[model samples]
Target: MKVEKNISLLPYNTFGIDAKADLFIEYYSLDELRQVLKEHKGERILHIGQGSNLLFTRDFNGIILHSGMARARFLDDETVEAQNGLRLDDLIAQLTDMCYCGMEKLSLIPGEVGASAVQNVGAYGVEAKDVILRVNTLDVETLEERVFTNEECRFGYRDSAFKHELKGKYIVTSVVYRVKPGDATKTREEIIETRNGKLPKIGEVGSAGSFFMNPFVPEEQANALLAQYPDMPHFETPQGVKIPAAWLIEQCGWKGKTLGGAQVWPKQALVIVNANHATAEDIIALAAHISQSVKEKFNITIIPEVNYI
Candidate 1:
């Protein structure tokens, strides 16, 4: 484990923003994590994995904790236990090759295992919460280890308890996922093709996948909008009617638009890319502008899916 001071966050976040962390620490084992937590009891901390789905808005005035552990083991023919720091795609590849079913739809999604349960990461109609059997965590306040079943995680659309009511209360250590032995090759290929068509390649462009969550609106509001835009795509959810944020952004005339190094990707309006050497402020400003335009045009508010640190 290494402890460093004033480390650049550019390498730690997907946005490529050159923010700094006051202190940066890495732990390779549970004992090392406990040691750091015990010694730095009251210090502010932010945990990270692969630096995906987040934007560092400014130099963090706290410690950034990262776990170095990465491992995955099959508990049986149909279940797997994976350590938190494992690259999500690596795990998916291994399981798919093993003929593990149901995970193929999530192939190539960015981020790590630890974030799966926290973000309830979803794509192509499948969500992490759907496969998660349980999540293992260490309670930072009491240094006690605990487990939460899928039901206890309070899984919702692109949300989980870890992100809301239980935010910052626990540090995820591992996750147990349920899988099956079946051919997943065809489905995986299709999902990949669909994503590649709309999303930028990871290293080729700087982005956090979808920048905005699809906004849900009441039936009346959706019907009103549909009257004007009969072709506007939507899905009905228990919350309300889910409106595609991409369509709204496109209607506001933001596709491929640029501002201060940030640009709405030409291929996908839901994505905001670091077109140049974008400062954190540049991305923030561009996002704000896009959001404002959508609000004015549709009378609907779209929330950011990316975490701002």
Candidate 2:
């Protein structure tokens, strides 16, 4: 278990943020991770998957463990197991090739399978929790291996028990997904149509996906907004009516707005992209500014979906 010191973290994160870690270790297997943990017992450890959803605020003093054990295998006709480091897009591609259908809705979401379960990542009316059968995790307190069923995961909108009650208490090792065969041509067409209509074209530019989760407000609040702006779009969720954060941001005239090297994507207000040499601070500040503007103008607060480390 070799550990590097004072490692630059810029290459690790998707935002291309410049940050450092005092101690960094990349694990290729579960045994390697256990050995490292044994050697550095009682030390603070941050588990990082692909670094897509993370924003590093400053240099970390403790160890940053990068899970590089990228392995994916089909368990059965309807089940696939993937290591924590397996990229979400890779998994989607594999499923697509196999004619599997459930993951198509999340085709372009960045990050690893482990992080998807952590946040119950969702898009286009589908969520990770919907297909996850079980999650393999290493308990931090006892160092015991356990499998958590979907129900045990306690999934919610852009939230899971892993993000709150069990924040750093467990290290997810792998995820098991239940999928079924589908018509490949039809699925491909659907994906193409959705992308063409709702998202930026491939290779267009920079982004960490959607910047904020659509804020769920009371029906009354939504109706009041509808009264003022009758064409405002909203969708009903299990919680309440979810007003698109992008629509609200667009209404605030933030789309195509640039701040330093960061810019609200011209194509999607829900996305704040790094247009040039943008730093983590710059992106964060722009998001805050947008949030503040929306809150002050519409009396609603927009919460970021991206995780800050």
Candidate 3:
């Protein structure tokens, strides 16, 4: 429950942005977090796990709670339980070794287990909500532990109840995922094939995955765009057609474009990478410029998937 004052946050975030926090503490257990919360009763708090999905806007004025406890175990024959602090990439690797197929698509996504369900993080056709059996949370208001089922999570396209109704109301402690046991070699081969002929590598660069969620547009609008660019990728969702944000961004000539020390990845238009010593403000400005250009050209406003604190 020890709190450090005026902590530098340069290494905490994936963007490597320089920022500071008035109070910062690393909690290794739920009891430690409870005790700290009781002692600092009136302080504003921000819970962070791996700090992948966040951008610091300025020096924080409140407490920063870093979830540092790491634990994972097989709950049963078809379920695995993991603490909030477990890295997403490590979890995926372990699951793949165990012949669990559903999480391989999310192999390269950054962040911890706790943040995955918050946005229903997805890639290549699969989403976190698709395999999550339940989420264990500590209610901030009542300080009670509860397990929410997948349906209760209200998962939508890149959204869930955690981001809407329950935002800032609970701290996710752990998650249970439903997975299957099969042949590891076959699963690895399938995943490798689906990677667009790329090798399986980790920690290649600084990124938080796709910066923007794919924009959902009406069928008519999607059809118009499809007619214009026959190869534009899209998927049919219940809402309408989910158009790839990368397509619009590439069409607008933003790929490989650099602003200050931030640049859109040349290979993946959807990813904004830290080309050098990029500041959070630099990345934010580049994203805004890209979004504005896309909107002006395509009449669609792109929504960022990353959280700005």
Candidate 4:
């Protein structure tokens, strides 16, 4: 276990926020994690992964936990169990190298295995839930391990039970993913190329991937919007008509637009980047402006996918 006090969080988050934390702990084993939890029983604790999907609004005043146990092992020919600290993309790359075919579409997505399960991170029509078989977690109160099957996770578009009813009650320790024997190099390469072209490179640019979730509107409303803009893109699903938030933001003339030190990514309007030493306030203000414009133009309210810490 490694513990530090009053540390800069710049290296931890992909957004490059310079926030500080009162306490930062990195546990290398499940036993160490349990010990930490037991020691800080009633204190506020936040378990973070790569911090890719988060925006630290201010210095954290409580414990911030991270895992240093990154490893993956094949459980059988078709399943693999990966520790929480393993980078999701790194695991995918390794699997692809070994000719695993299930997770190629998710290649290059930022975040770790635990956050993948918590956020249900998705891309190119594939979601973590689609490939995840089970999630191994630790009950915060009891310090006992528990396993949840995929269906028990109750996954929704880019969301899961971890973000809601079960929030803070359990900490995901590892995830088991289903795979098959097939060369996925081509698909993985294409995905990486596509993402690299559209999304900002991590470390080079500060961003939290997609800033907003695509809005789902009723069929009638979608038809109404389509009438006004015939070229509008949409898809019908069991939930509703899913309209890409990127298109909505672009139509509202937000592409490449800047506010304070933040800017809407030119290639992908779905992303908000810290263009030049942007403060959390600048990013939040810019997101609010974009959301308001989209809401004004179309009666749909787009919500942020990034969590503000």
TM per prediction: 0.98, 0.93, 0.92, 0.99
Q: Between which residue pairs do clashes occur in model 4?
A: none
* Stretches > 4 Å off in candidate 3: 185-204
Candidate 1 yields a Cα-based lDDT of 0.91
Alpha-carbon runs more than 4 Å astray in model 4: none
Candidate 2 lDDT over residue span 1-309, tens digit each: 557999998777777777999999988888888888777788989998777778787888899997887788989988999999888878888778877878888876778888989989887678999999999998877778999999999999988899988888899999999888885546555765776675544335456678888898999998998999999998987799989999999999999999988999887899888788788788999999999999998899989988887
Residue 56 shift from truth in candidate 4, angstroms:
0.7
Question: Total backbone clashes of model 1?
Answer: 0
Model 1 per-residue lDDT at 79: 79
Q: Worst lDDT window (10 residues) for model 4?
A: 188-197
lDDT of 4 by residue, 1-309 (tens): 999999999998988889999999999999999999999999999999999999999999999999999999999999999999999999999999998899999999999999999999998899999999999999999999999999999999999999999899999999999999999999999989989999999999999999999999999999999999999999999999999999999999999999988999999999999999999999999999999999999988999999999
Please tell me which model should have the higher lDDT, number 1 or number 2: 1
Name the 10 consecutive residues with the lowest summed lDDT in model 3: 195-204
User: Over the stretch 232-309, how does candidate 3's per-residue lDDT look in tens digits?
Assistant: 889898888988899899999999999998889888888888788888878999999999999998888899988899
Best by lDDT: 4
Number of the predicted model whose TM-score against the real structure is largest: 4
Predicted structure 2: lDDT:
0.85
Off by over 4 Å in 2: 189-206
**lDDT of each model, Cα atoms only?**
0.91, 0.85, 0.83, 0.96
lDDT of 3 at 300: 88
By lDDT, is 1 or 4 better?
4
lDDT of 1 by residue, 1-309 (tens): 989999998788777888899999999999999999999989899999988899998889999999898999988877799999998888998888888887778899998999988989998889998899999999998889999999999999889999987888899999999998899988888888888888988777889889999999999999999999999999999999999899999999999999999999999999999889998899999999999989888989999999998
